[model samples]
Target: MPSYALLRRRRSGSRATADHATADRTADHTAGAGPRRRLRGLAYLALGLPVGLLALVVLGALTAPVLMACARPADISSWADAARRAALLTFGILLTVGVAPLAAAPLAALERHRLRVLASAPTEPTAPEPRPHAVRFRARYTTARAWREVAAGYLVAVAGPGLVLLAATWAVLCPIWLAAPLVVARSSGGPVALGIGHARSVPDALPYCAAGLAAGVLGIVVLITLVRAQAALSRTLVEPRPDPLATRLVEVTRSRSRLADGFAAERRRIERDLHDGAQQQLLGLTLQLGLARMDLPADSAAGQAVARAHDQAKTLMADLRELIRGIHPQVLTDRGLGAALYELAEFCPLPVAADIDLPHRPPQAVETAAYFAAAEALANALRHSAADNIRLTARVRHDRLTVDVEDDGRGGARLADGTGLTGLADRVAVVDGTIRVSSPPGGPTLVRVTIPCPPHPQEDDR
Candidate 1:
């Protein structure tokens, strides 16, 4: 080992070297910052100009007639002219009102992408606003947010070209001005014209070069400021507005999911208790009764009583097993939804044609919901459909579980008419699933159930 003083000297050298390296890196970063920001500002201007021009063209085309109709001649002496102007105004208003919302959506999407890529802004694709009675056109098109987007689109169209023009003018002029001295030196002996005078040599162009350098620096500052302002405006207009109702709906959905999970866990607990505790006890009692009957005399009353008790005990045990299955099937827990469904088909009184193709099992709650919905639909078909054949098809596609049940029964099934479908609807709704009934009052009832669930990965490996 070296002496302590020597070691101290070596450590000090290392620290000094590290500090010098850090300082160099920082200086390099500082030197490059202006060019990087200038490039970013240029990119923003280039992108915004084309998008703004496109928006202007489209919006202008859509609203031109409306603007023209508003510019009616002061002299409306003829009734026909008045009527024509009114009709034109009405048509233009209707057209703009109808098409503006659709156009705004795509424009807003482009703006959002530009902001996210160029400004490094945190942004997300906006989901469509939810509304009740969405099937009606009025409900979908008459929202305030839709009009707000249209206004934003117009603003972007108008402002984009203006800002780009200013930025581009400064960008071109600054470079040309800064290179004045070089231009003067390269020119022929004849004088090159400056803004107010002529320069015959590089020395005479010094003032122009100084002015250009100053202007270029100032231009960079202005460009950065304008780019930031544009980004802020785009974000304000294009970003999704926070809706309290939507937020609350999301919270409610999460709470419902949690509750469903808790309920599923509780159901497993109950099924376990019955299977391991009560059902096992009942099985033991059943065996004891069978043994007691064997010991008694065949002709005596005690023997007959013991035999009857044994038969009743066996019946009760089977019923208890069925109850346990109804609560939560062991096959579902062990094998999967596919196996459980096929087993269910085996027990159905009617002939069931089952086609179940699942790559993997879904979540426990989803499986439970789907199984019960299928069971209910099958039961309804059997009791009321009055048809012979029933078909059941289940598959997992695009992260959704779709189960369809169809019957060739005398069909008059209706959800609101209280055919047990309302309960199924409610149950499916708890898991953010949907149930559709298509029984057109004559025959052939079809109940389609769709539940959103991603497949369980571990189950797929098995």
Candidate 2:
């Protein structure tokens, strides 16, 4: 039965040890394992050495008097009794005064090291299991979480020493030969056994020693167990989270589909408006003017009426052409983005300079978006920003086309309600281009846009 009990305790202890080892391995995996952790441990060891030495020296200094009194034959008949009492008193004082601050140093160092390890951990981990909780908790709860973790390290501090003390006390008591001094002195009942010399007087001292050893061991075990528990909790709580690749891919596909639909809808609206409204009006007006010109020779008053009708027809033709150009100009469709931008610069009321540098033509979608953004910027400069001179520059570089409209005008552009700038912003966004308007209230408004262009045409590149 005793053998069985011993075997069971060993097994339980082994499992606990294994669990702790596994936890540490997991934390190491979560936090970049390898020479780095070992290096950090070495560094902490180096730092902790001086501190440990200082503690030992200071404790020795404080304990010198007690050591002397225990060994002194003149002061006390029994050194064991004096030493044991002093040890109890000293341990109590140290617990009350010194243990807290002394333990804080290692706890703080460990925490700082752990945090650094966590920070250096891979943000995108490939492992299926979540990272050690300590790393995750720190990332989420930040400093507050780290503080709680540090506070929980005390359990380890208590357990290690407690176990050592238990082992030492067991050695001191169980040996029959070692206990002979007390047994012989008690049997003799001499002056040594009575009052001052009680190696013999305290017959039950052996049991008392065993009980004290057990208590000390239990306390230390509890402390270490508590610390390990806290460490496990931190690992389960703190690590970074990963998103499945499938979810991300699906979101991207949906966005592209929506953009394609928006592009097609915008193009159809422009085409229908031009064909139904502008093209038909221009065709009808041209026919009416031709009939009026043919009727001019019949009568003088009738000729004047015919000429007036022709003038009205000519005005309608001009409006139709402007409307058609606004929808999608023939020059842009035929010659490409460069020719369209040049025309825009020429029409601007301000003294505008054009710098068109394109190695090759971009896609139709890119060209259309760039042209309109430039046009809107120039219009804003002419109307709102009271500018005298403006510079228009366009370039296609490294598979990207960029348009910049800069003016030395009163500069206050904002994304307010019903502002044309807002619509211009939306138009740029539709093409996956971004517009940056740096219009500070006094003067000089600049609008720059960049759009991702498809592969350049080889002929245009030449």
Which one is best on lDDT? 1
The reply for model 1, stretches above 4 Å from the true place, is: 1-38, 60-105, 121-141, 172-219, 281-316, 334-367, 373-424, 431-462
What is the Cα-based TM-score of model 1?
0.59
lDDT of 2 at 385: 78
Clashing pairs counted in every model:
0, 17
lDDT (Cα, tens digit) per residue for candidate 1, span 94-139: 9888898888878887877777656434556656667665444464
lDDT of each: 0.84, 0.63
TM-score for all predictions? 0.59, 0.43
Between which residue pairs do clashes occur in model 1? Answer: none
lDDT of 2 at 310: 76
Which runs of model 2 end up more than 4 angstroms from their true locations? 1-281, 297-299, 416-418, 455-462
Compose the digit string of candidate 2's lDDT tens values, residues 1-462. 999999999999999999999999999886766566556433432433343344344444544554554564565548787676677667655553344344443454443444344333535434545788776544433544343433434332333243344444444544433444466555755423322224444454555445545655664465445434534543443332334686786687568647855764576478667777777877787787778778678468887777777777788777766666676666776788899999888867788999999877776667777887888888877888778999999987777788999888778877673446787777777667887778788867778889888664634311
